[model samples]
Target: MTRGFADRIPVHIQQVVEAMVEVFVNQSENIGNEVDYLQVFELSVDTADFFSMQAIAHSREEPPYSTTTEFVTDTAITEKVYIISDDYGLEGEVITYLLASEY
Candidate 1:
């Protein structure tokens, strides 16, 4: 997570990130060889209703929107887009979550 994004983390964003991490972990554990090392997510909130939000994790390999999950929660955080990817460096499989702008 970027320092800027981390400073303003919101509850709703927390929920969505947690959900995405669950999916990532499950996929890695159950289908290690077939899992994608990189995952991209776009988070858009309803301007009229801040309480509602939609998060899309795109995987063009899975057509039909390629969306992995969608979630809704109540909050006023304005996260635009972010990506979670695996970086197998000296730290082993280190996963990172950062804003698109930060990317």
Candidate 2:
């Protein structure tokens, strides 16, 4: 049987985790000014359920606003996949962009 890499050190893990966060950010930006859109992103690597995350949006009303989203090391994924985001909901700056799309 083929075995997966099971050891996660701080240095290597940091790099890998950062890469995953980048994926999330990219997916978020892919939404752009479009509405009624769904962007899906498969993780960079198959992570164990024990992963963690942290997310931050740099700006709300600008093109170059940066958003950093993190994931925890432990999450359950069964049946329907959970789409968790720090700013997915709530009336934030991004909301304006999405709302404007409604005409």
Highest TM-score scorer:
1
Worst 10 residues of 1 by lDDT: 58-67
Question: Which digits, one per residue and each the tens of the lDDT, describe model 1 over residues 1-103?
Answer: 6775666657567566667656765765675534555555655555434446554555423322244555565654555555455766887776566776777
- Give residue 1's lDDT in candidate 2 (0 to 100): 6
User: Candidate 1: TM-score?
Assistant: 0.59
What lDDT would each prediction earn against the true structure? 0.57, 0.32
Query: What is the number of backbone collisions in each predicted candidate, taken in the order shown?
Result: 0, 14
Candidate 2 stretches greater than 4 Å from native: 1-9, 33-103
The parts of candidate 1 lying over 4 Å away from their true place are: 28-33, 47-51, 54-65, 68-72, 76-78, 87-90
The alpha-carbon lDDT assigned to residue 89 of candidate 2 equals: 57
Q: lDDT for model 2, please.
A: 0.32
